[model samples]
Target: MNTPILLLQCLFLVLLSGPLFAQRWTTTSQESEQQPLRLHGSLLFQGIYPGFRVGVERPIRQTDFQRSNGRVNSHQRAVLFYVGMYYHPGFHLNTFAGAEYIFRRVGGRGLITEFRSSLALSRTFLGAETYRVGEAGIVETVLASGQFYAMPGLGFGMGKVLGKPGSNRPFAYMVNLNLTGLAPYNGLALPTPTLEIGFRYQLATTSVHFRHRIRTRQ
Candidate 1:
C-alpha cells in the first residue's frame, strides 16, 4: 500500500512541475487580436583587442660586416560591426543572421577590413534558482575571402518586465557577456581569442506607457 501511494505521489508531482515551470518562463500579450507584423532591425558595434606575434628580419651593416636582426611583439586594436534584422515567433526565436564588418591593425602600420556573414543560435538557461540565468550559443561566420568558420560561445543576460502605472505596456532591459570565435580559422591560419561586452535596450509600444506611469502616478 505504501509503495502504490509513493508511485501515485511521484506521478502527481511530475505532472504539476511542467506547467509551473512553463508559467515562470513565459508571458502572454493582452491584445485580444494580434497586431500587424512589423519588421525589426538592430545595429551592433564590437571592439576587439587582439595580440599577435610577428617575426621580422633586418640586414645590418657595421664595420664592413653584415648581420641579421629579429624581434617579436604583440599588436592590438581590432573592431567589428554588424547591422541586421531581428525576427521571431511571438518574440521567441533562437536564431539570428547578419552581416559583419571587421577592422584590424596589423604590424602597427597595416589595416585589414573583411566582410563576413554571421549566423547564431542563442538560448537562455535559467539556473537552479529562478533569478539566475545565463545565455549560450554557437555562431558560424563566413568571410568574403572564402573562409568558413564556427564558434561555440556563451553569455549572460538579465531582464525584467516594466509595467505602466496606469496603462498596459511592457518594457525590458538586458545586459550581455557576448563571446564569439571559439574555434580556429582555416584560410588565414589565424588562431586568436575574441571576447567583448554588450548592452541592449528593448523598445516596444510600452516605452510611452512607462513614461506615463512615472509622470501621472504617485
Candidate 2:
C-alpha cells in the first residue's frame, strides 16, 4: 500500500510539473546564462500525497572564478533551502536543505544537467486515531499524536534557464528523479523514487561577463 502510494505520488508529481517545465523550456534562450541566486516553486510527489514546494538557491562561492564562461561554466555550485506541502490522504509539510551540482550543459539554450542531495524533516497530522496505554491499575485511550519523519535524498535532473522577471537574467526549470528513504515510513522499509519538477528565478548574480572570448575573422 505504501509503495503504491509513493509511486502514484511520483507519477502525479510529474504530471503537475510537466506543464510548467514545458513553459519554461520554450522560453529558454542562448543569451541568458547562469545566475548566482535562484528562487523557485515546484510540485512534489513522493508519498501518498501530491505536494507543492518553493525554494531559494545561491552559489557556494560569491567570487568570480569563471566569469569568462561564455556558453557554459564548468564549476557551478549552490545550496538550496526549501519548504513544501502535501494535500492528500494525510496533510504533510516538509522542510529541507539541499546542495546542487551542475554537471553538464545540454545545449546552447541554457539547458543543463545536474545532481542534488537533500535532508528533510516532515510532519504529518493524523486525524482522529486511538491509542491504548495500560498502566498499573488503569487504561487510557489517547487520540492524535502526530508523526514525524526524516528523509535523506539524492536526485538527477535536467534544467533550462528561463528569462528573469523585469530583467532578462535567468530563470530555470528542472525535472528530477529523486530517491529517498524514510525511517519508519508508515510501516514501510525501502527507498522510494519521487519526481520533482520546478522553476527557479534568479535574484542576484556576481557577474555574467565572460572572462574569456574567442575571436575569429570570417
Candidate 3:
C-alpha cells in the first residue's frame, strides 16, 4: 500500500508540472507582444473566362446576324471590394465580394449580366510588414470556403516587395488567381477561372521621442 501511494503521488506531481513547463516553452518561443487591430480596404479588377460549358437553352439571336460562327464572346469583367482586419504581424482576416458583368448581345439589341460573390482568408508577409515602422517581412495568403453563384470555390494569392522599404511610406504589389463554379438556379454545375493583379501602398506616421536629462547642483 505504501509503494502504490508513493507512485500515485509522483505521477500527480508530474502531471501538474507538465502544463507549467509547456506554458513557459510556448511563451519563450514567440514574441509576447500583441499588435493592435487594424482596418484596411482594397479595390480589385479581374478578368474571367469560362472553362466549362455554360448552358444556354436558346441561341443568342444577335449571333445569328454575325458573319462569324454562332459562338459569342465569353470574356467578362469583374470588380471586387474587400475589407480586412490585421490580427497579427503575419496573419489577417478578410472578406471580399464582387460582380461580374457578362455581356452578350441578345436579339440583335440586348445584353445580359451575371454576378458573383466571394469570401476568403488573406495572409500577408513582406507587404504586411510595410505598415510597420521598421524592418521588412514577407506575406502569404490563402482563401477558402468561397461561394460563387451558390456554388463552392477556393483561391490562393501571394504578394512580394516592389521597392525599397521606407520610414514613412512603402509600396507593394500582388497577384491572385481564383477558381469558381457557375450554374443555373437548378441546373448542372460549371466552373470558371479568374486572374487579377493590383498594387498597394502603405503610409506610416512619424513619431518623435525625447529623452530627459538630469542636473546636480552644488
Highest TM-score against the true fold, candidate: 2
TM-score of each prediction: 0.26, 0.58, 0.29
RMSD of every candidate to native, in Å, equals 27.3, 13.0, 28.9
lDDT of 2 by residue, 1-218 (tens): 69999999999999999877545322222232444557878888866556777877655432111223344333345667777665545333343444444333334346657777777775655544546667665667665556667767788888776652122246668887788765577687447567888877766644333222222111
Best-to-worst order by TM-score is: 2, 3, 1
The 10-residue segment with the lowest total lDDT in model 3: 52-61
**lDDT tens digits by residue: candidate 3, 73-161:** 22122223343222222322222233322222212112222233453332222224232232445443433422223433455444443
Q: Largest lDDT belongs to which candidate? A: 2
lDDT assessment of candidate 1: 0.27
Candidate 2, residue 181: how far the Cα is off, in Å? 1.6
lDDT of 2 at 97: 42
Candidate lDDT values, in order: 0.27, 0.58, 0.33
Give the Å error, residue 97, model 3.
2.6
